[model samples]
Target: MPPLPAFNPSTECPPPGRFPLTWDEIESELVKADDFAESSTRSGLLEELRVHFALVEMATGAVGRLWLAGSFVSGKLDPEDIDVTYLIPSDAYVRAMADPDTVDNLDNLGTKDWCVRQGLRVDAYVLRLAATEDFRALGVTGAMAPDDHKVFESLGVYDEVWQRCRSGPNGIPRGTRRGYVEVVL
Candidate 1:
């Protein structure tokens, strides 16, 4: 993975796309880089996210990669929360959705609503991948049905959507693009 870029002065966030980082790098860059009042807050949030990630994976068994966005990934001194977008395997999604036990965890991880309800500062979203393999080389294979080709298209849609965010760090809708951090679990 490449080194993360500095935050934009205006958006207080990095440029748009996925910036993959190792577990240690994530802790170092996002948490320890800033020596401020919010350092402890960031540390706590990281731990909370670890537990949440494990719980989600145990329930659905679909988490392949995790992208961090929102204020926590920004230059904010004291962000209220961390935003997570779970990149999951398509087959795992089917299995989890079909399984009866995943309902509660899946339902609770629906969006940012769980943040307020649980008295935590973590938000989540889901983006399913066509396969757990190289996505760049992926396309409509002859073995796939015509309708199923849309799955590949959906990946692009999710990429675009996740790449876009408010231009400002205060959550105002200024329509700016910012990259997210993919934390290695």
Candidate 2:
């Protein structure tokens, strides 16, 4: 497999300090894996999750709950992207929007752009707490499915799977736009 690209969070115009694991950082974390065990993915996922969650906490000043609601948690290894949901309180939205820095940081453009800039094939979404029930249901159903290979089909899961089973336009959106940060790959 080819190496993943690096990501730099800093911008010349507004100058947001670099965030979380850069491409080098992610690679180092992945390289430390003993033999691509489940735990290895879990560790790498956790690292990425922490970085994403920290950005939310720092930008919103509100600590929200995070749930792994996509292929990563559903036993799918060939995930095209990471999927997660941030349960942010409704009350915090206004405050977050009032602050330009927070709003700017919350934009998918910044996150996506950062990943592309780093050469990493990653995409992220932010979903509000209120929108998670459906996602949670989808995740649970996928997890309980009998066939690991068929789990994606069982719940109509896609985005991070092998090409043969990739979903079409009906596939779930890469990320939800309402939450603070719903998905990251």
Candidate 3:
């Protein structure tokens, strides 16, 4: 795999592209990129990400893919929260939705508002399951279901949105954009 790229100076963001990494690698690399003063804050934010991941897996049985976006993935110092996108397979989504016990977890895992209410410093979103570069571990095969089309569409939107800079306090992007990293499970 290629090394993680440096932040684009102008936007203070990661260069526009996909960087697939592991949890260990994300901690070792992404965190180390921040200044010394930001170390503790970065660690705490990473912990929140771990908690968010566990919640997603508990609710869905599997996270088809995990994506890291927003300021947390950028070169910025002391980002308030980490933005995460969990791509959940349809089968897992159905199971999670059908279970009353997992509803709150699903709800928390699905939206940014619910996550804030739960006191999780994670801006979360769940999209139609996406295929990783290597799908073997994820149990996705060569076969493409009709719904895969929607998954592609969903991913495209994420790519487009995440690639842009959060222009103002409201996060309405006004043209400027950046890149994000994907967690390799």
Candidate 4:
């Protein structure tokens, strides 16, 4: 074979401050999404988005949880965007990404547009089961299904939070005027 191209760090690598997110950070976002999911006025769009990926696992056999993270979960006011991730089994994650149909399903989900309509940034990812574990922990069994529930349980986010977000908050009355149009997920 011909000589391989030499490695180029500058062009190939992310610059300073741009790094793959850590498990600890994901844990923190669990808290943030839980809290944000609690705020009735703020969580309208997010709540609607909770179900867009229901068909994800069925389509790919990727058993995992969905996560919302980043600056929006960091308690920053008017964060540039909201970050979401689908934590799935390692084998399934690879397969899903490689399949065009899976990609198309994600595209049709319109997660990014929904976030933008609410005036927020959107950074989403699909993390493998192993990557979701706390490497620093002494006894890490790796990810489990129902993976999403495990994430919330591991991160100390109560079912009440999930329950509230799922049940739908008592939103503002219609025809009463609103700054942003309600999104349908």
lDDT for each candidate structure: 0.74, 0.42, 0.77, 0.42
Candidate 3 TM-score to native: 0.81
Estimate the TM-score of every prediction.
Answer: 0.81, 0.44, 0.81, 0.38
In model 3, the worst 10-residue window by lDDT is 130-139
- Model 2 scores worst on lDDT over the 10 consecutive residues at 9-18
lDDT of 3 at 108: 59
Preferred candidate (TM-score higher): 2 or 3: 3
On lDDT, the leading prediction is 3
What is candidate 3's lDDT per residue for 1-185, written digit by digit as tens?
Answer: 56578777777777888898888888876786534255556778898889889988877898877889887887667778998888887778777778887877677566877776777789888775643345454455545555666778888988888887766774445787677898988
Cα RMSD (angstroms) for every candidate in the order listed: 3.2, 15.2, 4.7, 18.7
lDDT for 77 in candidate 3 is: 70
Per-residue C-alpha lDDT of model 2 across residues 26-143, encoded as one tens digit per residue: 3343334333354435555556556766776777666454433334422333444455444455457557778887777878423766754644334555433332234445456554
Report the lDDT of model 3 for residue 69. Answer: 88
Which stretches of candidate 1 lie above 4 Å from their native place? 35-40, 132-141, 145-148, 167-175
Between candidates 2 and 3, the one scoring higher on lDDT is 3
